[model samples]
Target: MASFGWKRKIGEKVSKATSQQFEAEAADDKDLADDDEANWVHATKRRKEILLEDCVKKSKELKDEGANLAENKRYREAIHKWDEALQLTPEDATLYEMKSQVLMSLHEMFPAVHAAEMAVQRNPRSWDAWQTLGRAQLGLGEIALVGKQTRV
Candidate 1:
């Protein structure tokens, strides 16, 4: 009976040791999973920042091209380039104003009005945008006046 008691004690100790080993392994696994998740999140953030930087760079290039085209009096092409720039930086009132100017030169009254309106939306306090809007409105008014005169 004494030997049987000793054996039971030894068995309990072995079972307790095995359980402790399994718990330790589970804790290690949990730590590794947490580390992997943190790394993945950091990588994703870096990728997004890189993409945004690329877009900003491309927007700048397009803006330069738009300026060159406008200087050459290629108003339609300049407007197209400015539109591409705006896609990358939609908040730029300057781009919108430039596009509005191009459209105005082309005598595209409605589109000129719309582009000036977008410029105002991007920056209400922008003097250039306000001026562009005023000019576009004047052009539209002139057309309307002409139509009325013709009808009469």
Candidate 2:
């Protein structure tokens, strides 16, 4: 019974040692893999660029339709079309600017300000966005001063 107990203990130690050694080798392989030059984040960025390109065409079509509606002074329908275009490409600064224009036509100064702000945030380099934001701010200020007798 004593000899049998010793054999079982030795078998467990051997199995544990083997497992540890295998795990150590696997870790070493992972360390080597960490040095690989094929950085995957750039690949992901490229894929995102491709997806953005695909969205561009459809979003532009919706935007053009919205523009025609806006030209006809159909502001509400234009807003709906703009909303769908934005859903297709939410990152588009131009869309936000257009929506801000429609909101201004509706005299919804607060919402126009919000939309213009979104356009600026999406593309700070866009002069149109900055201009729209400035206009919205002016409109809001005018409403507060003249309509509401407010300070802000």
Candidate 3:
């Protein structure tokens, strides 16, 4: 898991303040407190959610920029922008799928295949990711066959 230091601190502060307020409100009622395990899980989830929102916001901006670049046929520049987005949201399967498509267009068979594999691993149910992987594999096979034919 990626270290989200600031996100965790902010989340903890919010949770602590909220908990204290709730405690004060319930002081006279004597309500039972949540167990340690539940508190820990809730804190962890809140921290993760905050970090995910931040990354998603940043990554979406970069992905949109990459899409515009790709529309202009600037494949390499688009790939660079997508690469930046991936650093922010490494598990975004769409980024991986799109990056592999650009790599395939650039005839980077191995890297295309690798990116597609990452997409598949990130989201096994994503048909777009599977499609990109299939295209890369097919392209690589075709290239190998052509090479063999020339050698013979």
lDDT of 1 at 120: 87
Top lDDT model: 3
lDDT of each: 0.86, 0.85, 0.86
| Candidate rank order under lDDT | 3, 1, 2
| Model 3 residue 44 CA deviation in Å | 11
22: Cα error in model 3, Å = 28
Per TM-score, what order, best first? Answer: 1, 3, 2
Instruction: Indicate the worst ten consecutive residues by lDDT in candidate 3.
Output: 28-37
Error of 2 at 148 (Å): 22
Model 3 lDDT on a 0 to 1 scale = 0.86
lDDT of 2 at 65: 95
Model 2, 87-126: lDDT tens per residue?
Answer: 9889989999999989999999999999998998999888
Higher TM-score: candidate 2 or 3? 3
What's every prediction's RMSD, in angstroms?
8.9, 7.8, 16.0
